[model samples]
Each structure stands twice: as structure tokens, then as C-alpha cells.
Target: MVKGVILRQFHSLILLLFMLDTFANSTDIQPLRQLRPRLVHLYNWAQRTPDYNVIWDLCCDHGLLGLHLHQATTAYGTHVHLVDQVEPIVDKLQTQYAHRQDGNLSICLTPAEHIRLAKQAKQLFIIAGVGGETVASIIQSILPAIQALPPSPHQQIDMLISPNKHVFSLRRALQAMPFTLIEEEFVSDKGRHHEHMFLRYQPAAPTPPSEVGDALWLPATQDKRIYIDKLIKHYGALSQYSPTAFNQQALAAYQALKHKLFGE
Candidate 1:
């Protein structure tokens, strides 16, 4: 398909996410229903679907997202997948949702294992509470796994991976591979600053590979410019903390962003 067609179809799912039927106060999973707002917003962005959206809570302390999925009708229809490396977490998750017996939800013991089961559903892989490099590593590992599968005209992997740091390297990896950045935001959630990029990966067309070009960039989007300016200043200020921390790479990145955004 053409680029325009691919973009429209991908965005169609996002539009669908917002338009989905309401469950009318259906989200009642303990500890998770309290977090519905944050988790749902992230899920919408991940699936890029306004109607039926899938979400996975990869690095969860508990199955917060999954609980909401089982409790909420719209979320249930969205096909929620839970993946974790810890056996205890998965065991608790299975036990927690067992009483409800919601077949819509599935709990997986591992990321790779979950990936196999989720292939049939419109997927949104969520990996948070980890460093950015690890998140990028998981994405890199899945590149070939996704390619190995036979193309199904109707299936796609819609994902949102959030890592606390190493986002710069993650950006580099995305640029190095085939993926389209749909929406990116740097928010101060619960008073802590975070960088979250939501993207879509599909087999229909390859994303135009990008390069950092000796320096990185930060865009000027109203209030965002202030944050970017502060970020540049912060890194520049780091030179005072430790000489090693103030390296050519950091200086170069800061300088490039300053010039690009502020025309300094």
C-alpha cells in the first residue's frame, strides 16, 4: 500500500480507541481501577485505536492494567495481555483475576512467550519501570521475530515502551530500524519527569530510517520549548558536578539542541 494509505489505516485504530462503547463505571480492579486514567490514556496511544485497543503491563509491580482490563468492558474487548519475568507476579496475577474468570485477559510468564500469543490480537506492548536501554533491547530482539511470521492482512503490533532513561539511545535504535513515531511526550507524572514515545510497527511498509546526525534535536512546541531549554541548561550545568559527566558527547548534544531550538 501507499504511504498515505498506510498512515490512514494505522491512525484509524487510534480514532477507534476513543469511539469505543463505554462500560459505565466498569473498571473496578483493586489498586488498578485507581490508576485507570493513566493506564487507559497510555493504552489509547499505544493501540492508536479509538475503538478496540490492546494493552500489556510488562514491568508491573502487580497486574494493574490487567485488572482494569478484566473489570472494564471496553478494556476487556481490547484484548489485554500481561507479561512478566517474575514467577510470583504472574502467579498473583492469575490468582487475582481467577475469581472473575474473564476469558478476555491472558497472563504470560515471559515477554517472548507473550509475543507469540499476542500475535493474533491487535497488540500494544507496554514495558515500563526499566531503563531505556533495556526497553530498546527488547524492541530490537522482536524485530526479527515479527519479520519471521507470515503476513496476515489484518494483524499488526501496536506498542508503547516507556523506559526511565537511555531514551536517547532508544531513539537512535528506532531511527536505525523500521518504525514510525506516532506521538511522543515528556510529562511530569506525579511530579516526576518522564519521556514517553508512542509508535506503531507494521509489516506493510518500512519506516524511513533516521540518523542523529552528530547532534540530537528537541522541538519547540509551546510549553515544550521551555522544558527543552531547561534540559539543555541542565546538561550544560552538569559540567560543574563532574568533569567526566561533562564530555564532548553531552556538550555536543546540548549545543546542537540549543542551536536548533533557540538559534543560539
Candidate 2:
């Protein structure tokens, strides 16, 4: 038992050393290169947004996206807030970045619904790598708080969203909100399809988010075509099995969208 304990301790020490070394090496590497293709796409989309004072990266697991954004936007005086519900994730991120005295980086231990931003600052929120339903819930919870904030000509709030599943539900949720679609992309990465949307909140805008997006279908790249077919199949199956009103509607919508796009 004593020998086993010593061996375990030795293994733990080796792991600690390896992790430290890896982290030290990673610091010198380009942060963007370390991200997955999906995140890299998000980073690119984020770069296109007009100057914003603060960015909130919700559900920031491992803080990679937030860290990269902080590095890229620090010169612009943009503050990056990384939020997660997990205690260990937040604690580790705080410790990892504690050496930096810059006020631009913040690690918060909280749920996405509770995120607070500067009322005066134009903010961007990126919520990715989660299901559409959860993202909808988070957005719904925060809308009231966000609506209370004073508006500015330069204070438009933007959300960069990439939902992993049930994307139609997310779009439906957005359609009920004050947000209008700014841009949307259909991305296929590592055999997974993602719909990335850039939306801005406009209280007076007449148009709401579309249940099925417009731009993503018009171009109809091969990936988009494939994705639409997949979505039709999914919704079609759901409609047949469940036959719920929404599922039937979604199936019809996608079918109509496909026919409109490819005349199929």
C-alpha cells in the first residue's frame, strides 16, 4: 500500500510538471491556431463587428475563445468577460490569468443569465457550443435586464451564436425577441453542421428573426444544400413520429425552403 501510494504520488507529480510545461509552451503559440475551426470562424465573425466596449463570452469552457478575444481586442480597449457556471473552470481561469494586472480580462463564476455589462458600453455576446434550446433560455432570461439598459447610437448589442442542436427552435425564440438578423453563415466542420448568426437588438425594427434564415439559403453552397436536406429529413421524421404542430410546421418550412432554393 505504501509503495502504491508513492507510485501514485510520483505519477501525479509528473502530470503536474507536464501540464505546466504544456501551458508554458502554449503561451507562445498563436491563440487562434489553437482553436477548432468553428471557433476560428466565430473569431473571424467577431472581428467584423463594429467597435464595442465589452464582449461577454458565455459558457466559456476553458476560456480559449475569450482569451483569444482579449488578446486581439486589448489594443482597442475592449474588455473581455469570460463567464461559466462551473466553479473549477472559473477558479482555474482566474488563477491562470491572475498574473496579468490588466483590467481588460475578467473571469466570472456565474450563469449566462446573470451576466451584467456596462450600460453605456456597446457589448457583444458570444454563446456557442451548446444546444439551441439552452441558448434560447439564456437569451430569454437576459432580455429583460438588457432591455432596461440605456440605449446609445453606438451601444447596439450584438450576439454571435452557434447552436449545436435544435437550431430551428433557437431561430423561433429569436423571432419573438427584439433582435433582427444581421448576418448568418452555414458552416460544416468535422462532419457537423452549425448555423452561426450575427444578430443585433433593435427595439424599433419591424422585422424579426426568421424561423428559417434567408441568406443562408439563397447562396446554397453544397454544404448548405446538404444541411437543408438533413434538416428536412430530421423535421420530417419528427413530424411523422411526434406530429406536433411545431414539428409539422418546421418540416413544411424546410421542405418549402428547399423547393424554393433548388426547385426540388
Candidate 3:
């Protein structure tokens, strides 16, 4: 009885300390209402996707998006897995979710490439808030597993990726792969342009992914226009710096895109 009482008191003390810390740093901590626009857009897009049995939020920092997904998808009996390589982050997440009885949520301390993909279950893997190179590397590591899955009428594995940089190279690398683009969007948040893409895996893909993205130029939104300008400038600088055939080609591609869009 005495040991039980002491354990209860320790738990109460830990809770009180957590509450105090939260209260002290409340200004620095962004509430759910203040989630970044890019994340909000990603979540909204994920919500539009078709039925899925599981979601893997890879490189999930702070677990905001995954937690939000869990809350929303729990009703549909979806399992949400948040994976991060950081031990501290995984520990904190485990603590936060220890009380849940639903057994549908999992927190894994592993690299995105290390997690096993569910072959039979419809799954959506969300890789966001990381550079395109990292995202590409993770995809490369997991491509073999994705390819081994049995084909189904509903795609066995779908992906939603939002990478902050090197999107062109990432797309170029994916062009020869089995991933087919289903949706694309450009979001400007905190003075950075993010490319969000939804893709499905097929053993025999019908359409090759565009290296520079086909539909990004169609809408001509202010953000898209600005991002196009940045892309042109970026490629121009790269071409000057290296003058490689590939760099020149990339530079010319963006310049041509600009002319096509603005009639320059």
C-alpha cells in the first residue's frame, strides 16, 4: 500500500512539472490552432485521399501531423505510426501516448527506410518537412520492398511528400521509377516554397513523372509565379557554377518554362 501511494505521488509530481514547463514556455510552443500553413495544407490533402488502413509519418518531428492523423483516422480504424530516428523524440512520444487504449497508434525509433511496410494493408506513407535529398534516399531504400508487394486494384502503397529543396533532382530521379504522380501543389510558408506531391506505386507505370513538374505552371498563382522565378535563378546560378551538361539542361528547362508561362 505504501509503495503504491509513493508511485502515485511520483506520477503526480511528474505531471505537475510538465504542466509548469508548458506554462512557462507557452509563448514558444505553438498550439494546434497555430500549426504552420504547409502542415495544415498537407493534413487537408491527406484527408482527401481514399481509404487507407495505415499511415506512416516518417521523419515526424514533434509528431504533430501524425498525432493529428491519429485523432482523425482513429474513427476509421486506421493505424497511425510515427517514426523518427531520434531517441529523445521517440521517448517523449511514447510517454505522451502511453495512456492510449486504442492500440492503433505506434511510435517507432527507426530510420524511415528501416520501418517495414504493410504489404496487404492499404498504406499511406507521409514524408514531409525534410529536404528532397533525404526523402529521395528514404524512397530508394524502401523501393524494393514496395515493389515486392502484391498488386491490387487499390494501390497497396501511396505516398505524400513535401520536401523543402532539390525537388527537381528528386523528380528527375523518380522519373524512371514506378511511382506515378496523382496530385501536386506548391505551398509558400514562412518565406519558403514547399512542393507537396501525392504518388501511387504501380508495377507498370503508364506515365513517366515530369522532371520539372507538369501542372505546377498551370494555375499561375502568385506563390507559384514567385517560385518559378526562384527556380530559374537557382538553375542559372548552378549552370554558371558548374557549366555541366546536366546543369545547362536544367537551366534551359526552367528558362523555357518561364517563357512558356509568361510569354517572355
Candidate 4:
């Protein structure tokens, strides 16, 4: 009886080891899950831009977006620069990717405003996962440095930004800038609505629309309607508490958008 019991326990241990090995191998084989829709949208937009020499994933927290871009665009000879203001995060990322032999990745511990752009390089800066006001401030601080660069064949710089809240104000700020809006889209992920715009610094054009482009209203998806409804509710609540001119104006604009989109 004792011999039989020992044999059974040994077999169980072997089975457990086999299971662990299978799981470890499966992790290596399985591709990472698809990125969140907002990240995917940003990635796709950057891919469609006129060839870029460097892509800066500014405010990159975990460097996931930069890593994703690095994996996707390394063959094209594009460099991915991941910048964050925190030193620990940067250190962790540097250590995580230390084994990579490719020279296409860079992890920097610096603020978005102070990042050094390659002179004459076609650049795309992606700033997301933050509030609109902060996004505007970062861009405002960086614009002067970018404007100082000497012109080249690939001097154009593109910025793709997505703000978590106060999108209307961000839209106004972008419209006021010298950049031309290449494309803008409203994307909904996990019931949260986000607006992302691809803008290039090209002078000699009138200001774009203060709101997200008219295409937002033209989309008939339920997600679009849901997003509009959330906006309307949000502004309506703010107007009730503040009753200020700005709140009133914002509320009215959102209500009008709802009426136009849903014929309410």
C-alpha cells in the first residue's frame, strides 16, 4: 500500500510540472492582446502619417505604446522614443528592454516640454491619457522649441493627442494653433468616450472648428449617440451647479448636438 501511494504522488508531481511547462511555453507563443481601442486608433493614425524618422510617445507611463510602435515599425527604420517625467518608471522600462539588441528603442526620463527633437527629422508626437488642460500646457511649452528648428525636407512635426476630459477646451486650443488638422475621430472604449486628432504644424490656414469635426455628428453608431448623451448630461449637471456663462454656453452647445444627432 505504501509503495502504491508513493507512485501515485510521484505521478501527480510530474503532471503538475508538465502543466507549468505548458503554460510557460504558451505565454511565449501567444501574442499580446489587442491594445485598447484608443491606443489602437493612435497607433493606426501614426502609421498612416507621411514617413516619420522618429515617433515620440510622450507621457508614456509603462512605455507600452512605444513598445508596441517599436515592434510594429522597427523594420521601417523608425526610432521610438518613450519619454516620462518619472525616473523610476523610466528606469524600470530601461531595465525591461535592456535585452533588446535593436537600436530602435529609447527610454528617456524627461518632461514632454523638454524632450530633444531630432533636427530635420520627420517626427510624430503622441500625447494621451491625460486631461485636456494639461495636454494643452505640454504642447504650448514644446511648440517654441519645435518652431525653432531649421527647416528641412522632413521638418514637419505631427502631434496626436487624446484628452480624458475637457475635450472642448482642448479642441479650441488646437484650432487656435498653427497646426492643420489632418484627421479627427471620436472613439469609445469600454463606455468611455475619447477624441483624438492628428495635427501637423503647417502655417497659412484659417482656424479649424472649435468642436470635434463635423464627422462626429455624421456617424450613426449607437456608441456615438451614447457619447453625445454623456456629454449632454455632464454639461447639464455643471450648468445646474455653476450657472455661469461658460457652463450655460457649453450646455447649450451639447444640447444642440444631441438634437442634431438624435432629432430630439
TM-scores for the candidates: 0.67, 0.84, 0.82, 0.84
Question: Which pairs clash inside model 3?
Answer: none
Show model 1 residue runs off by greater than 4 Å.
Answer: 1-31, 36-40, 46-54, 73-76, 118-121, 203-205, 208-247, 262-264
List clashing residue pairs in candidate 2.
Answer: none
Candidate 2 accuracy as lDDT: 0.85
Model 4, residue pairs in steric clash = none
TM-score of model number 1: 0.67
Model 2 clash count equals 0
True-structure RMSD, every candidate: 16.1, 7.0, 7.2, 3.8
lDDT of 4 by residue, 151-174 (tens): 887587888988899887787777
Q: Which regions of candidate 4 fall more than 4 Å away from where they truly are?
A: 1-33, 206-209
lDDT of 2 at 128: 95
Give per-residue CA lDDT, model 2, range 152-209, as digits (tens).
7657788899999898899898888998888888777898889899888888973666
